[model samples]
Target: MTASPNRGLALTVGAILAIWGILGFFFAGEGGHAFFGNEGGYLWGVFLVNPALCLVWTLLAAAMLIGGLGTTIGSRNLNLLAGVVLLVLALYGLLFMNTSANVFALNAVDNGFNAIVGFVLLLTALAADRENLRALRADRDDLDALRAEAAHG
Candidate 1:
């Protein structure tokens, strides 16, 4: 009930890495499991694909996602950790999944998602790289006082 955005995003990243890792754990017999009709299998039951690394990635993402949510809901720094993880994973996805033609179109879609997530995380990390938060050279109160003084004083 009312989960934070970081928590939601963490779940998403966790799910992606976890599912992919678990799926990798399952050995596919070439020809794409015969059920879907492709010719791709997870291969080596995920051992060769660096299952451990995927797990690490998931754990990092979990922290960062939660942290990011903390930042969003609490303070700006709450999600810095999560943002880092997102950036790393985005790069990882781009490096590992982007060029792969093994999984048909799935890899492409995943890579696209990875790019989006990474970019968003980068923005969050950079605080949108905002030039300023103030509306003008002076504060609102100052502007209001000026206006009031000009009008009555």
Candidate 2:
């Protein structure tokens, strides 16, 4: 069977997010710093990199990867929804980076990263949808052409 247009990209993004989340836990205990820099008691520079965030990332990653791999209608819808959710989260991070209630410790760096990832996911989903539509249209056109040829011959 033909692979989905965004399957490879979704898999790569899922793997990266999963690995990053897992690595965040490495410094979960006391004295743990953010992965890139010390921020919010995390080894990384992002906001509080705790077990909870790691779990969230892992779950999101699993959803994206699994949905991309599956051929069911539910899976395709899941993939699209995941992309939309990521975009929304990124927008939230960027818009509330300096708010007092910003408990996620999302700084400019983290927000930027989130925005980039979200954009990538959104683009991949749109591209995939476009490709599928194009393929369907091509198939329809080919069928029509064949019918015409047979009728005239």
Overall lDDT per candidate, in order of appearance: 0.46, 0.64
Sliding window of 10 residues with minimal summed lDDT for model 2: 33-42
Q: Residues 25-85, candidate 2: write the lDDT tens digits.
A: 7745447534333234454655455454556667878886786676534344665676677
Cα distance off (Å), candidate 2, residue 127: 2.4
lDDT of 1: 0.46
Worst 10 residues of 1 by lDDT: 128-137
Q: Which ranges in model 2 have alpha carbons more than 4 Å from their true place?
A: 31-39, 43-48, 72-76, 133-153
Give model 2's TM-score versus the native structure.
0.66
TM-score of each prediction: 0.39, 0.66
Q: Give a tens-digit lDDT track for model 1, residues 33-143.
A: 432222335433322233333445456555554554443333224334545555565566555563443222224444455456656654554553233322332466698
Q: State the lDDT at 63 in candidate 1.
A: 57
Clashing pairs in 2: 33-42, 33-43, 34-42, 34-43, 34-44, 35-43, 35-44
